[model samples]
Target: MSDRYAPDVQEERRAAIVAGLVTAAVGFTSSFAVVLAGLDAVGASASQAASGLLILCVTQGLGTILLALRYRVPVTLAWSTPGAALLATTGMVDGGWPAAVGAFLVVGLLVVATAAIKQLADLVRAIPTSIAQAMLAGVLVPLCLAPVTATAERPLLLAPVVLTWLLLAALAPRWASPAALVVALTLAVLAGDDRSGAVWPGLAWTMPTFSIGAVVGLAVPLYLVTMAAQNVPGAAVLTSFGYRPPWRAAMLVTGVGTIGGAPAGGHAINLAAISAALSASPEAGPDPSKRWVAAVTTGTTYVVIAPLAALLTAVVVAAPPGLVAAAAGLALLTTLAGSLRAALTAADRAEPAIVTFLVAASGISVWGIGAAFWALVAGVIAHLVLRRTVRAR
Candidate 1:
């Protein structure tokens, strides 16, 4: 009876349900830009690409729900939107969907290995919270400027939505950051940009083709970027809320989810931050000790929704591209800034961080993998070499 009637317990249950759905929806919305890029990279027919994203999303959403449920740790899992962007420009450039899927699998394996090794999470944990916070801010900075960057050739497309995003974001962060996107999409619909209001992806699937290009360009870089950019921050989010999730369990879940999503075109799976923010609040569970159930509930919901993913993707595609870009870019500002700071600060490692930041910011491509992976590698190597002599001293 106490368990049933406890206000905090009840509140937490309520928050879990609400936040789970909101996270799934917002995460799907947030991921569209990279999905678009991935679709184009494979040179898929519009309908095929659209369907692929739907499948990818469903896999990601279902995987998130599963991991969340298994650990009951509020472990919000999401595919790497940034990973998709990398695939779009690099991996899929020379390859097709088959190769793209191959990349996904390889990367998923890497994530699993990281978990098995248990060293990756530990390394990230070693960083000071102040440094983590700074890194997050730095990563998110460019995302803030993305809207402005797209305006030159696409003002007609990006202007109104970007303006609306800026107004709402500066005025009311909580309401604006997530809901502004829904509102922007609605306005786009009223203006008739939603060409496929009712059309949805019919049952469709693609078999993967293994290729060095996809593996190096799409898979390897995607894995690295998602790990550094998304997973690290996700852990920080949990820690910030005073929960230290079991790294082995969480990484295994992330790895499993990534593998599951690979066949369907997913990029990577990592823990959540902003979305998980909902379940971690005091309202979700006053005890905080028993908050695992909330994540369980969330993961279960993702699985339930998986079958209908194509339908959901159809809905996501209805929004105008410009509006989608603006909303996603806005939503990610904080995150991008955070990554940037991590890459930049560190007086001893400033040079490497700068190199990493510049390369990532440059948006260049090498062998079909995006710059984020290279940036991280570059930074890591620089940091190691520079610190080696100091440590020896």
Candidate 2:
């Protein structure tokens, strides 16, 4: 018989709801700008950018629902924030937004292909943990620094937001970032900015236009970063929490979602790393079996809020850019700290990890490719050199 009326089950379900809501809020407030900035970098119009955001939310939301239900685990899905950061740094490409959409399609194919090819999946799995963590930390540096810079430049706008975050973080850890986001939204309303007007965002489709430069520079690097920096770590996080989800099936579903969303301006969607823990962790419920409820609730929240993408875009676009940055930085602070800790935990790999972090944080690009790819390359070389030196000694 089902334990539907049991007191423990009821408490677990309630906790799951809270976890899901918190995760959804954090996922939306934290990195939404990176997505917008990335689309803008690739020459998307305001309407197009809104469409992309909506598409991403919808697809990832659906993926989260499907995966959690199919696997009976908290399989959270998210757009690749690091991939978006790479796009932001890569600047405009030839053939504009269409070219970017083409790249997105190719990335989807690559993800699907990786699932089908054991060698490719194994190669991604072979990337050193320290290097991957370092790359993630580096990509997050600028975003994490936003609150510090905002405090200096826009104290009046950012002070309350930071104060709220600090207070909540001390007393109610999980809700701290979301509370800060609430403060930001409240302040944005009080500012009386006309640009904050609400309008429902409509879909805008663009035909894909493939260029060799776009394919090599954007598609390949995007696929690599999403897999290395997001999916792999996401799976590891789940494993750490004792959920052995079907990895290949999850990748296949994400790939299909990515492909479906590409023409509507969505970039890559993958397994979520930071936010996955919010739903999958023990705090979501005492019963491991009931934790999937949190993932389902998160997916429902995303789908419900997808249509409000235009309103959110307006709010962010209207707010003092510094204020928005501050909110985002605050949301990512915990993630940044965790990644840094993971990257530096190994004594032997520490130096190479630092190399990776610095290169990625530098935001330098060469031959139209972003710093993320180069950071991995540099870290690998540093690791090999250091190992050889130790052997000689």
Question: How many steric overlaps does candidate 1 have?
Answer: 31
lDDT of 2 by residue, 1-393 (tens): 466668777888999989998888888776787787678788887678889999999999999999898888998999988788778766677668899999999999989998899998888767777887788788788877888998998888789999999999999876788778778877876773766455458888999999876887788778877987789889989999999967998899999999999999999999998889999998899888989999999998998888887877777667766786677678777867877898999666589999999998998877766677788899989999999999999
- The per-residue C-alpha lDDT of model 2 at residue 33 equals 70
Residue 8 of model 1 has an lDDT of: 59
- List, residue by residue over 1-393, the lDDT tens digit for candidate 1: 676577755675777566656666656655555565455555554556555565555555666556555655666766666555555445344467767777777877888888877576566555433333332333344545656676665777666666766787778665555565665566566654456655455434557678766676556656656765677767878888887765666677778777776665555667765667766666456667666666655656655555554544454466555555566567666566555555455455566666565666666667655555565566666667767977999
The TM-scores of all predictions, comma-separated, are 0.79, 0.89
Error of 2 at 338 (Å): 2.4
- Candidate 1 TM-score over all chains jointly: 0.79
Against the unseen true structure, what C-alpha lDDT does each candidate score?
A: 0.61, 0.85
Candidate 1 stretches with Cα past 4 Å from truth are 2-12, 42-45, 88-91, 118-146, 149-159, 192-199, 300-321, 366-370, 384-393
